[model samples]
Structure formats: C-alpha cells, structure tokens
Target chain A: MPLKLFELVGRDAARPFSPYCWRTRMALAHKGLSADTIPWRFTEKSVLVPYGSERVPVMLDGDRAVVDSWAIANHLEDAYPDRQSLFGGAGGRAMARFINSWGDIAILGGISPLVLADIPKLLDQVDADYFRTSREARFGKPLEEVMATRDQAVIGFRRSLEPLRQTLKAQPFIGGDAPDYADYIVFGGFQWARVVSPFKLLEETDSVYAWRERLLDAFDGLARKSPGFPV
Target chain B: MPLKLFELVGRDAARPFSPYCWRTRMALAHKGLSADTIPWRFTEKSVLVPYGSERVPVMLDGDRAVVDSWAIANHLEDAYPDRQSLFGGAGGRAMARFINSWGDIAILGGISPLVLADIPKLLDQVDADYFRTSREARFGKPLEEVMATRDQAVIGFRRSLEPLRQTLKAQPFIGGDAPDYADYIVFGGFQWARVVSPFKLLEETDSVYAWRERLLDAFDGLARKSPGFPV
Candidate 1:
C-alpha cells in the first residue's frame, strides 16, 4: 500500500498549511514517493490519537506509524535507502538537525507572529475558536494584538535571517547546489506563510526571495501547485 | 616536511587565538593530521605575503599553500581521504558551509562585544596599539566603549545562541554523537573567547557550556592545554 500522511488543513481541505507537514510533503516529493494526504484540522486531535501523535505530518507506511515531520523524514530515508538520499551522509544528517533547529527557532518562530492573526480567518468556526483560545493563552494576548506590531516586528525577523541570507547569497540552496532536507526544513515555514497569509515576509530583491522562488518551482512546481498566496 | 599552519597570536606565541585558526586546528585534529604552528601576530602581515593571502590559518601542506580555515578543511579532507573524514560526506560538506556562516555571524559576532576589551590586554604594546586602532575604527568607538554595555549586552548574546543551545540539549554535539567540522566551526569562537578573556560568556548551567567542556577535553585536551583563561 502507498504511504498515507495526516496533514494539517483548515476549512479548505485542499490547503495543507502546517510548516512541519510541508517539510514532510517536500521530503516525499524529493524522494519521488507519493503519499495520500488525509486533511487534518486544529480541533482534530482525536483523529491522530490512534497514530500515537496529536500532531499533523504523522505518516502511516503500512502498519508502522511515524509521528513528527523529522521522524517521518528519517523513516523515509532509512526505509528507502536506494532512493536519492535525504541527507547526503551521516555528517549531513547531523548538521541538518542544526538546520532543523534553526528552522524551528528562527524561521518558523520569526514567521509566526507575522502570520498568526491571519490563520484563524481560514479555519472553521470550531477550529478557529480552538486556535484563538490556545494561541492567546500562549501569547497572553489575543492573536490580533500579538500581531499588531508585525509591521515593525518584521524588521527583526529579516535580521534574524542574516545567516540564511548570507548562505543563500553564496549558494543556490541551503543544501548547496541542490535542494536537500536542509532547504526543505526552512522552506516549510515560508510555504506555510504563503499558504495562509498574504503578508510580505520578504522583499523581491532579497536573495532569500529568489531562493524561495526556485524551491517553489522545484519538483514540477509541487509546492506551487498546492494552494497558497502569491507570496 | 610536516604540514605547517600560520595561526594568529598576540604576545604569547603559545596562545594562538584566532577563531578561524582554531577551526582549522580542530579540523586537523579531527582528521588525525597535525601541523606545526607558525605563530603570526597582528602586525605581521608581511609574513603571509608569499602565501597569496593576508590571513592566519594559511596551511602549508608540503609544497601546496591552502588559505582560509574553510579551504584548509577542504584541503585536509581531499588530501587525506584515507584518514577520518572532516565532513561525513558531500552532503555534510555542503551543510557545514551554512554552519560556518552561522558560526561567524552568530557565535563570533555575538561574542565580540562581550570580549572585545579583554583582547588587547593579551597583546604586546605594538599589536595592542594596532588591534585597538583597527577594531575601534571598525566599531567607530573605543574598544572599551564598545564593550561598556556588555554586562547587560551579554543577555542578547546568550539569547542569540538559543539555536546552538537547543541543539546541544538534544544531542551531545552539533556534529551529533561526535565532534565534526560543524562542531569545530562554532567551538572555534568559544575557544577564541576562552583563550583571551575571563568574561563569562556561558553560564555554568548552560548546555552549551557542557558541550564546550566535552570539546575542551577532545583530542586529549589539545585546546585546553593551550594557554587560555579558565572560562
């Protein structure tokens, strides 16, 4: 049987928006593997309970279930070693973990405030309520209020990406000449922003903007074909 | 002849303290290769003129001259394929470049202000004058003035290390189970700071501190044996 992946979505099942899920999606595409997507939503924890996860990007490859995007990427790499390697070698795999941490802390965390307020608008009432209540508790304010200073906050976000920007200036992708798991790790956050929010996270002249354009066009435009804004 | 490396020092030749040179030092040790250190001081630019570069860590591997820490690493990896790998593989080699950039910008840059004032004290009168004039010009302020707010500024430096700190919490080293070039890349900055300053860059409780401790003990205390303050 083909692999099946639980991907986070909202009111529109066609739009899979979770940053972690996009990482797995791109990883699968990179390996030339296809997974049937099971659209998940914010309030759908019960759906993943049997899979031993309360998160999206949980993959079912036959009877074995892999939870978390990072785990799923590892599972895919180990299970299909004959396919193109996700990490070039042991070294790449280890360093990619650093990249993954940077992706979570720097890229995803940086983009969250800019896009948080726009997320609930695309969710169903129940999911929207769940998102707002949970997120507000985390931020100690309403989502919109958290995002009120996003215009000014984005300058810091851009500055936080200096390492990434500098790297991309010297190479075509984070993985160097070819897109690898490292590139997918960061691009997942950008793709998530594009899917849900129209906010301008990057200027067109930025090298990062150009790198994203290349990844968007990668794998026969697999990411582009997925529903997302022009960002 | 055995390999030779020109490493930056201040007054005491025993305390070679350029962050880039430390990176090459650790990389050589990782590859089980040793180079005789040619101590280069701040005012000794003429010594490197024949090497086609004005930088320390210009490695002389027999008849060949390899310049830059990154280039020296690549040279070692390529020249001694029979030895242990500096980068795990091609994928790792590519990703290490990103880590290298992060080390320079985040680790070295962040630590500069916190330890800048202490650096000149480690140098001789001639080198100290040159160092202060050059660094002050770069900062557009006196070295002491640039570091005046470092007591409070260190907070931001610690916060900037969140990604590296987070990675160390999950793994023993940035290179994962063992130290690799990626580990050396960031550790070079920490080692540089430790070599010149008594400033407390990492709290005793920080995971990064533990990671540094392990590295300090790596290669049979190669870095620790070198003259440095007890950071």
Candidate 2:
C-alpha cells in the first residue's frame, strides 16, 4: 500500500520546524515505504479536516488515516519492518520515544521564539489581514500580546538551549554514534531555524551543524533539494 | 529484569490528578511495572539534570534514561509486551501513538491555560522563593506575561476538543472501548485541571468525566486521593 502523506508548503511562521512532520518523513524514508507527499497550504487546511485537524503531515495507508507525527512514524516502522529501523532494537525503543518527546517539548519549545522573530517579515510576504485575523483566531490574542509572548518564549528558549547544546557536544547524534528518529526530530527544529531565520542561529553549534550536514548528505539529492516545508 | 522509573512528587503541580505525572503512573499500572517514586522537593531537580533536563516523569529502564511523559508512556508500551497492551494490537499502535502526540500538542495545549490559572494558589502552597524563581526561569517574564501565553495555548486546545470529546462520547475512551496510552495522556492533562482549578471545566463533557471516573474507580480510592505536599 502506498503511504500518502499530507504536509504544508512553507514553514508555518507560528510553528516552524514541525518536528512531528519531520519525524514522519524520516520514518517513511527509513522504512523504505512508498509514500507520496501532498504539499498543503496553511490557508487550505480546511479541505483536510475530514481526516482530523487542519494539520499537515497526515499519512494515509490504504484507507487507514494516521494523523500526528509520532503515530505516522510508528506505523511506517511497523508496516515495513524490512527497512532500516528507526528504533534500532528493543532497548533503543524506549530511548527513541523519550528523545522524540524531549525534542517536541524541549527542543521545539526552545526554538519557537527564535523562529517567530522573523514572523513579521514573513507575514508581510503573505496576506496581512489574514495573518492578523487567523493568528488571533488560533492564539486568541492580539498581535501585541503575541509579540510579548514571543519575547518571553525566546527567553525560555535560551534557557533550554544551554543544556541541549551541551548534550549535542557530547555525542555525534542524540542516539550516539548514528542518527535515528531523535536526531531527525531535533534536526528538523534546527533546520527550520537555519533556513528561515535571517541570522542563522544553528551555525553557532559546530557539532549540531556537522550532524545536519551528515543527514543532508545521506538523503537522495532530489529529496534533499526538494522545496519542502517543515510541515 | 526490574523495570525502573523516576518520579518527582508534584513535579508539574500539586493537584491529585496532575495529568502529566498521571501518564507515567497509569502506564505503570497498565504494564504492572513497580518502580520507585522519588518524591522531588522544590528546587531539587538536580536528580534529573545529570541525566537530562530537569523534567518530570522520568523513567530509567536499565541503562536508558527516558524523559518526558509521552516518551515514557511509549517506552512502557513497547518494553512490556504481555501485561495489558497500551497499543491493543498491531493495527492500533499507530493510532495510539497519534493520540498520544495529539494529546501532547492539541489536547494538552488546549487545556494548558486553564490548568495554569491555579499557579498563584499553588505557589502559596509550594516553596515560595523556589516557585517564584522557577516561574521566572521557565517563562522569562513576570507572572502576568507568562500567564498571557496560555491564551494561545488554550485556543488551540479548544479547537481540538470538540471532535475529540465527540469521539469519546461515542466510546468509553480515546482508543475505542478500552483504555490505551492515548486515553491516559488525555486523562492526565484534564485530570490536572480537574484537580487544581476551581472551575469544573471537565464536568461539561460527560464522556470525558466518565472516562476519568473509570480510571479513578479502577485505581480504587488510592488513585482519587492526593499525595499531599510536605508542609
């Protein structure tokens, strides 16, 4: 069965990396699962609500609908057991799950404020009225409040980054010698910051950048060069 | 092999039904794993920092140090096969994982503002200096500014709740008739709110309340009772 994936086109200014989408894509590649990506526009998510939320990175295996990145990653892993394993072994499974969650809360939470700093510029490129109205709808706050929230969020991000950067320095990837699901999720967040931010914050960490280089080098050039957004 | 766990008493909040902590506890109940619950005092997450960030609901199984609620829950389901399966069967694992992530981002994020509303009352009950300092550390702004972030978090949560609550109305739990990891994660967040908030937000939904009651009833009086603070 062909795995059909639905994802966003540009990195969402509100949520840039979308570790969830990255995890699914990584799993699809690792599992050797034949999956097609459907590029979705954020404004057009209403069309896909039948599957779940207007969230991108929804996967369809035959008739079964799998939304959320963690679930999709697992389904692909189980569905195609012959491919390279994301979890590696039974012992590694727990570690993988823990790292995935850590990436979501710790890494993504840390990186979000930094990503949002450029949102005003991105909003100018898109629809201004829609951006203002839609953001308030989603966040229930005016632009001024959201901006203040972003500043606070960035402070929180900086605090989290210290320990995380230290950890990255200790190992080649989160899973030690090789890259795995954990690495991919964290990499997605870092990649989002790298590609979207004008300042390029990821370059500060040589170890992290080295890991990103390895991941980019490992993938097919076409997939690597594809105009993909971090769903 | 002995299953291991790391618990920080009132790690997230002091409420009897802290949803974040409950995910780990409920999973332990499901897998029948008896591990130590090290009661954590305020400002003493030094125990967690060496292993990872000072995050709650940590699980150290053998050599692996698993952190975060979703990660620990998934680890338990994957590591323990025979005891009541959190995934149910092969087909259900993906759905279970999705529900887990959905709860983390959508469900938990939705209800977070409401949950945090009680922080002031909770602060009085906790170590005053530590509580205030910790708030400053995580939110990086005054309590008011930190409080504002909830507006967005809650909006996203409410958007996800209708469909989720409807799904629960049709069934006893998120994963259909029986309880699964997803149900527990959902239960944890709401339970935290129910325990802390003066407002009875969960009472509005029968199925959601009933589901909590089921878990409360299953764990007997033991689950319903709070583990009091060390005053």
Candidate 3:
C-alpha cells in the first residue's frame, strides 16, 4: 500500500514551488514508496482543514496525519526502515535533522520576501487581487511602492546564505559524503529558488549551484516532474 | 559512564530558552543525563560556529555535533532506547512529530507578534538593540499596530489548539497517558505565552487550562523557568 501525499498545485502557493514540499516528495521517491499524489488548490485549503494544519506536503499513512515535511520524511523513514532513507545511519540521521531545522529557520525566512518581488504576476495566476489590495492597505502604498522594500530584503536574504556557503565550501553536501536529510532540505529549498524564483540567487553560490544540478540529475527519471502536485 | 550532553546558553540569545531548546532539556532531564550547559553571549556564538550551526541547543555527544533540536532529541532517543522517550511507539512517535510540527509553524507564528509586543522593554535589557531596531523598522509600525493585525493569527493559533484541547479535556496531558513530546511542545509554547501576554487565550479552552495548571505544578521544584528573554 502506497502512502498518501497532498500538495498544492501550480508553481507556488504561499511560497512558490516550495522546497519544503519538494523535500518530502524527494524522500518518498528515495524510499521507493509510491504515494497517491493529491493535488491541492491553494484557494481551497478547506480540504485539509480536518487535519487541523493548513500546510502543504501533508502525508497520510493509514490514519496517521503528518504535516511538516521533515516530520513526514521522518515518518516515512521510520515506517520503512529497510529502504533508502535520508537518515540512514547515526550520522546521516543527525544530518537529516539538522538540515530540516535549517530549512525551517534559515532557508524559509531567507527566501520568503522575494515572493513579493513579482507579486502582481504571482497573484494574477491565483485569480486573487487580495495580495495587491492587502499590500496597499497595509503599507498605505502602491504595490510597486511596497515592493520597493524588497532590495534590502534581498540583501538580508543573501547574507543569511553566508553560513551555508561557508559550510558547503567545506564539504560536498551538508551531511558530508552521502546525501541525507541535509541534502534533501537544502536541495528542496534551493531548488525552489533555483526553479521558481524570478531571482537567480543560487548563482551567487557556485557550490550550491553545482549541488542543485547534481540533485536534479540524480533524481532525474525517478523524479516527479514539474507541477508535481495535482491540478 | 553517563551520556554527555551539550547546550549553549546565555542571558537570552536567539537559541536561548526557546521551546526548541527546552525540548532537548526535558529530554535530557528524562534520560537522567546532567548536561554541561555552556553559557554563550549573543556575540560569542563564534565558539560553537566551527560545529557548523550558529544555533543554541546544539548537543554534542562525543564528537557528534547535533545542531538541531529535533535531531538532538532523536539522537538521544535512538542512542538510548532504555530511556523513556517522548516518542514511545510508532504511533506515539508519529503523534509527537505532528505536535512538534504544530509548535514550529502555527503555534510559534501565532505567538511571535505578541512576543514582540514589548520590544521597547526588551531593548532596555540587551546591550545591543540591533535586533529590536531592525525588527521594529521592518514592521514599519509600532508593536501595538502590528499586534492589532493579529486577529487572524490569533484565530489560527487557537484553532491549532482545539485538537489538544479536545484530547486533554479527557486526560491530564496531550499524549493520552502521560506527558510526552506533544505535551512538552504545547506546554512550553503556551507557558511562554502565558508569561509574556496577558491574554488568557488558552483559558477559553477549558480542559487545556486545567492541564496547563497541572503542568505548572509539575515543574514546581525545577529551577529552570522560561523568562521571556531580555525582559
């Protein structure tokens, strides 16, 4: 019996092509666990309201409801310990946990502001002008005027990458040697920036750029292609 | 030989006294491991930077530098199976993971704006006011103004609590039988909020309030208290 995975369709919902969601998908693929993919529409998160968490990449194994990507990934690994897991050994497990934490605190916070850079186009696809109106109302400024605040946000985002950049320069991946939770996390997040963002921030970090390419190639045929979620 | 545990502490750094940090602390306490708490000032995170993550609650077991809380907790549980883990069995483990996810996303996000409500007072305690200044400047509004925008955040936070409220209504804690990771996550977060904000938001949820009172009494003799950092 395959696991059930729910993801939001389209490029990105709250944050486009969220690396967070992709990490779980990658783990499922890595584990060779075929999941019944449930494509979700952002506008109707009510479908998931019963689970009590309004987040994407929720996995249901039997009746178990796992919301966070790392948690879902952890569940997958534990449920099927013999398969290839992001947390394979003692070190790998630690690496996986660390990477997941980094994704939550550092990676997500770093890239979130840029979603506003192309808010008009991003919102147009959703058929909701609420983001524009909300920005205007909240900032008491025009969409463009509020978006003007993104440059400094970009700088701050770039600076947050310094620790990762320095760390990656020391090793091939965050977990050293084999790809673990760290790889999936950094990959999933950076891939969102790599694939979806109008900004090409990964180019600034050559090792990260190379790492992204490697992950894409490694997961090539087995990888769930673009718009991995249901439409 | 006893299991060696590491924690970076300070007056109130980013990694200081967070629910994430306390999760590891409680786990350590449960394991009968007396940890060597390294007090780190905000500027001196450099001491642990070589271990890779700048975050506090980084646990070093031998040479293994486990940087994230979830990872640290898992490491402890996996390494010491005899110890009573918050993750009891597979089912219990899954539930704990779900609750932990809720803490990071909905619970923390819901509580953060309120936490920053007294930024001016927090600024008085810390020698450097850069974080507070930057946070205030980013909000582009007073703490009162930002807090006024919190109706939805409050709603979401409270909604997240409903399941635990329903569960705890029947039991003394979230994990049905005893206090586990779920209880720890819920208790630490709400405890932090109970001290920081006057709003007894959790009070409306009856069973949860009774559970909270019982939990408050559970820690009566423990020296550790969550002082809402820098205040």
RMSD of each: 1.0, 10.1, 10.9
TM-score of 3: 0.47
lDDT of 2 at A94: 39
- Higher-lDDT candidate of 1 and 3: 1
Give the per-residue lDDT digits (tens) of candidate 1, residues A203-223: 899888999999999999999
DockQ of each candidate's interface versus the true one? 0.84, 0.04, 0.04
Best by TM-score: 1
Off by over 4 Å in 3: A11-16, A89-98, A117-127, A130-146, A149-152, A221-231, B1-231
Model 2 lDDT, full chain set: 0.59
How should the candidates be ordered by DockQ, best one leading?
A: 1, 2, 3
lDDT of 2 at A47: 68
Candidate 1 regions with alpha-carbon error over 4 angstroms: none
C-alpha RMSD (angstroms) for model 2:
10.1
User: What is candidate 3's lDDT per residue for B1-231, written digit by digit as tens?
Assistant: 434444433334433334566667666765666666665543455777777976667777776788877777778778888877655543344334434555665566567786667433433345236445556697897667777766656666666455455455345565545566556666666655654455545544466666766665554423135454221
